[model samples]
Target: MSPARGGWVILLSVVLAMLLSVVQLPQGTPDWLAWLRPNWLLLVVFYWVMALPHRLGLITAWLIGLFADVLHGEALGVNAFGLAGITYVTWSLYERLRMYTRAQQALLVLVLATLLELVLLAAQLVTLGLSFEWMGLVQTLVTAVMTALFWPPVFLVLRWLRRHLKVV
Candidate 1:
C-alpha cells in the first residue's frame, strides 16, 4: 500500500496499544500478573517515534499522552508530560536507536521506561498526595523490566508491519 494509505496504521496501532495498556486480566487473576503488565502505549510510541521520526513529533505524542491520562484515570497532564518527555528523547536519538541491536534497544527501553515511570510516579505523589511505599517502587521496577522484556517481540511485529505495508 502507498504511504498515504498506510499511514493510518500508525494511528490504529497506537489506539490498540492504548486499549491494551489499560486492559485488565480476567477475574481471579493474580496480582503479580498485574505488575507484569507492560505499558503498551509507551512501547508503541517508542517504536513509531523511532521508526518515523519525521512524522511522529512531540505534539502528536502529547495528544496521545493526554488521551492516555484519560484512559488511565490519572490526573490530567501527568501522563501527557511523561509521554511527551520520553517521545522527545526518543526522537532525538532516533538515528542511533535505529542502528542499535535488539538487545541494546531493549536495554534502552528499560532505562526509558524506568525514567518515564519515575516521572509519572513523582507527579502522582505530588498531585494525589500519595505516600511512597517500597512495594510501589518495586512494582515500578517490575513494570519497567516487563516492558523491556516485551520490547523485542513488539519491535519485530511493528517492524514487520511497517515493512509489509510499505509505510514510510
Candidate 2:
C-alpha cells in the first residue's frame, strides 16, 4: 500500500461521501424523532483520519468543511473551523484510535460526530449571532446515532477497499 495511491483512494472516497451528505432531501418528521439526518461526510472524514492520518490531515478536513459550508449555504468557514478542529483532535489521537476495536471505534465516532455538530452550532452562534435552538442539539444527537449505527459497514467496506487495492 503506497502512500500516493492511498491518497487517491481517500480523495475519491471523500468526494463520494460529500456528495451523499449534501444531496439528500429532508425526511418528514417522525413522532418520536424528526431532526435525524445522516452524517455521511463526518463518518468518512473520521474514518480517513483514523485509518490514514498522514494522507488526509486537518487541511483536507478544513477544505472539505468549507466546501460543505458553500454547498449548504451556511455561514462561511463555520463548518470549516469545526471540521478542522475535530480533525486536529482525531489526528492527534489517530494512533490510539487506530488500535481500538471496531465497537470502541464506533463509540468514539458517535462522540466525535456529536462534537462536530456542536462545534458547527457554536460557530454559527458566534459568527452570525444566531439564536440557539434546542432542535439543533437534538439534531446532533440524531446525527451521532446515525453515524454510530452505520459506521461498522462503512468501515468494513473501506478497510477492504484499502487492503485489496493496495492502498495504505
Candidate 3:
C-alpha cells in the first residue's frame, strides 16, 4: 500500500497508544501499582519501527516523543530523546530483529523499555533532582517487564492490522 493510503492506519494506532499511555488508575490505587501500566506508546513505536523502518520510524517517534513530553507536562526533550534513542536502535538493528521469534523480541523489548525508562529517570534527576536514591528504579524495572510481557499481544494485533489493512 502507498504510504498515503496506509499511513492513517499507522497514525491511528500511534494516537491510540498515546491515549493509553496516560490512562490513570482509580484514585487511592497504590503508587507501586502504577508500575503495571505498560508503556503503550513505546510498544507501538517499537512495532512500527520494526515493521516499517523505511516508512515511519525515527522522526515520527521523535515527534510523538515531543507530544509525550507535553502529554505528561514534563520538561521538553526528555521523552523526545528517549524515543529517539529507541527508534535509532531499532532502525539500525531491525533486520536482525525481524529474524527473531516473538519470545526473543520480548526479551529485547525488556532491555529497550528499561533503557527508555532509565533515560526518563536520568532526565528527571538532572532536570528536577529526583530519583537519586533508587526511588524510581524498581518501578522502572517493573514497568519494563510489564511492557515486555505486553509485547506478544501488541505485536500480534499490530501485525494483524498491518496485514489486513495492508499498511506499508
Candidate 4:
C-alpha cells in the first residue's frame, strides 16, 4: 500500500482513459461511442484524491493534468490548472468527505465534476479566447451525471484493489 504503487495505478488508469477517449467506434455516418468522453480522467483523479489523499495530492494531480492536456491536444496547462485546483479543493475537504456515505459521496463528486468542467471552460475561454456557451454548462452537467453514475463501480474496483492488491 505504498504511495508509489498507488500512483502507478492512478497513472495507468489515466493513460487508459486517454486511449479510450480517442478510440473511435463506428455505428453510422458519425462515430459511435463518442459521447462516453465523460471526464474519465477527472473521475480517476477524484477517486485517488478522495481515497488516498496522503498519497496522490495536488502535485500528482497537476502532473497528470498536464499529461492529459498533451494527450487530448488541449491548450497547454489548462487541464493542469483545473485539475490541480480541483484536487486541492478535494484534498482540503478530504476529512469531511471521508465521513460521507456512497450516495453522499456521489453528490460531492457531481459538484466537484461540475466545478472541474467549469474550471476547464473558464481556463479555455481565458487562455485560448474560446467562446463560452450554455452547451458547455450542459456538457459539464452531463459529465457530472456520468461521473456520479460511474462512481460506484470505480469505488468498488479501487476498494477491491486496495484490499487485494496493495494500493496506497
For each of the candidates, the C-alpha root-mean-square deviation to the true structure, in angstroms, is 1.8, 2.8, 1.8, 2.6
Better of 2 and 3 by TM-score: 3
Q: Looking at candidate 4, what is the lDDT of residue 10?
A: 68
lDDT of 2 by residue, 1-168 (tens): 543665778878878887877664557646454345568788888888888787787888999999989987778887788778878888998899888988998898888888877877787777888788888777778888888888999999888988988776
* Candidate 1 per-residue lDDT over residues 54-158, each given as its tens digit: 778899999999999998888889888888988999998999999999999999999999998888778878888989988878878888999999999999999
- Writing each residue's lDDT as its tens digit, candidate 4 over 1-168 gives 433565567667777777766776765745324544567777777778888788877788888889888887778888898889879988998889889998998888788788877877787678788787887777777777887888878878877877676776
Task: Give the CA lDDT, 0 to 100, for residue 58 in model 4.
Answer: 78
Error of 4 at 9 (Å): 2.4
Report the backbone clash tally of model 3: 0
Point out the worst 10-residue segment of candidate 2 by lDDT. Answer: 29-38
| Candidate 4 TM-score to native | 0.84
Q: Give the range where candidate 3 is weakest over 10 consecutive residues by summed lDDT.
A: 1-10
Clashes of 1: 0
Candidate 1 stretches with Cα past 4 Å from truth are 1-5
Residue pairs whose backbone atoms clash in candidate 2: none
Q: How many backbone clashes does candidate 2 have?
A: 0
- Residue ranges of candidate 4 with Cα displaced over 4 Å: 1-7, 29-33, 128-130
Name the better of 2 and 3 by lDDT: 3
